[model samples]
Target: MRYSPNHKLETKEKLLESSSVSAKKSGFATVGVDGLMKAIGLSGGAFYSHFSSKDELFAAIVERELCQSLARLGGHGEQDCARLERCLKHYLSMAHVEQPESGCALPALGAEIARSDILVRQQAEIWICRLQESWARILDSDSLAWAILSQCIGALVVARMLATADIQRTVLQSSQEEIGRQIAGRQQAICK
Candidate 1:
């Protein structure tokens, strides 16, 4: 039976959402088209209706996930340093470290993203640069913005790799402390 156009759109949406979460939680390269389709209650053959290939879906996922990261971490163009400070605190928190599927795609999928085709990598670059630009405006220093952005993503990856919560917390706290020191040294009271 033929479904409504809306049904098709909705199914595609569900597939993207579910598949992205699955990819983030368990590297995208690990799952097949059939598995991704199954997560959305569709047959593997139906995958062609939404995307030409898994690579196409991956590009879409990269765009969707990074767009979300930009929105969450990039804040409005208000130049409020505190906005980034607050975001950093939560970003380096245990909750984010514990939830790969629901957190930023960078740490969980960065390796996979790096290995993806040029187009997917470019899509990630666009959003990442946008996020950096947002922070650069707030911090008034491109160097600091890049450093903090890299540090935050790295800290999360480190925290998640440890086998114990104490060590994970330490990794996060150290990064948070270092980030605080960096911001303070460059622009004292900027985030206060």
Candidate 2:
């Protein structure tokens, strides 16, 4: 059988996509290479053809996930406060908290990434900075961006940790309101 010139690239992309979802749904360290390959209908042996090792796959996943996240929540050059508000609302919503497979990778896999090897950690740091920069540009304050990003990620983590829906909602709602107030206060001060 003959494969197209882009077949290898396409297969790798499919693997990355499938692995990313699995990693977000279950921690990267918990999902073995065989399981990830099987998720995409590929044999375990074929995994080595795509990635040199599990750590390499993990680093790739971090890069891909963070890029997708930034594009989704970064507002794409939007400088208005409304962009920030929308990002916060969507990021802090129950849907995002409950759906790990399709939601932001940070809250889903942040701790694992932190404990990962230098390569994986570096990839995460690079993408996280891009996310923070997007928020900073929108809010017109670097410090505000860091604060908001930290709060949103932390809220999502805490909300997911709790067993009850009510407590989760409370955490998300409170963070959203408090972060909104802080952004508004910053905007007001800038206008003064």
Candidate 3:
């Protein structure tokens, strides 16, 4: 039975959406196509109709994940720099760590991205560059931008591993406050 082109596209989107969420939660390598399709009320046969191979689907999922990861960055403007800092602070907080599904793909799937294929790596690089561009606006120097970005990534990665809510919150608060204080110092240095 042939479905309309729209229906076919919708089915494909459903597959991508489901797979992305599952990958973010359980790691990309662990989410099987068959299982994902089954969860979305489709069969393995239909999976091929939408995707050439798992690698192709993974690239698509990575792109989707990347978009989701950056959606909170908002538009760049005169005020965007401040907004971006707050957005990053919010993202790296304990609230985000406690809720994986709603946060950036990095904390949820960074390790998996490291292990993924070249295509996924390329996609991740594109996302990172875009983020750097966003971050560069608020920061004065390239080195400062890289430093803050790395600190945010590392803090989130470490914060996610703590066993208790209090410990996790403490980690997030300390890391964020320390980063903020450093940014303040750097900004002051830039003016002097």
Candidate 4:
């Protein structure tokens, strides 16, 4: 039997939601059609009704995952610097880096995206744009926000790659303090 439009849309949304977390935790390439469908009480054959192919699904889910991270990190704010600080602190904390499944996609799936297909790359750019815009919102300058995002992402990626918790914490704390100072200095200069 054919499903209604609403049903089809709902299925697609569920598929994206389930697959987003799975892809984030297990890398997009590894999340099989069978497993993904099974997670949402559907079968492999039904996937095509929602997505044309695995790459399409990956693209959709990646966009969603990045958007979620951006939102979590306070993507938009008028002047609540404290909220932005809290989000950054949480982002770079040892807990965030230690858990790939529950952390930002930048550190968790950066390498995968770098090596992924064009569709995924395009989605990655959208994510990058979101982050850049989010940072600009906090710093009030497009360049400064992009710079801070780059530094934070780079530091988190390197820190997560380290073999020991101590090194990871060191990287986290050090980057956090340095970035914090930079942001404060920028804001102070503006105030002065």
- Off by more than 4 A, model 2: none
Q: Report the Cα RMSD per candidate.
A: 1.9, 1.0, 1.9, 2.4
Clashes of each: 0, 0, 0, 0
Model 1 CA deviation exceeding 4 Å by range: 189-192
Model 4 weakest 10-residue run by lDDT: 74-83
- Predicted structure with the largest TM-score when compared to the true one: 2
By summed lDDT, which 10 consecutive residues of candidate 1 come out lowest? 183-192
Q: Which lDDT values do the candidates have, in the order given?
A: 0.91, 0.90, 0.76, 0.81
lDDT of each residue in 7-66, candidate 1, tens digit only: 988998999999989988998989999999888777999999899999999999999999
Regions of candidate 4 where Cα sits further than 4 Å from its true position: 1-6
Worst 10 residues of 3 by lDDT: 73-82
Per-residue lDDT of model 2, residues 146-166, tens digit only: 999999999999999999999
Q: Quick one: best lDDT, which candidate?
A: 1
TM-score of every model versus the real structure: 0.95, 0.96, 0.90, 0.86
lDDT of 3 by residue, 1-192 (tens): 877869988998989888887877777787677888898998888899999888788888778877766566634555444565687788777777877766677777778778888888899889877766666666766676778777777788788877888887777788778777877877788689
lDDT of 3 at 186: 73
TM-score of 3: 0.90
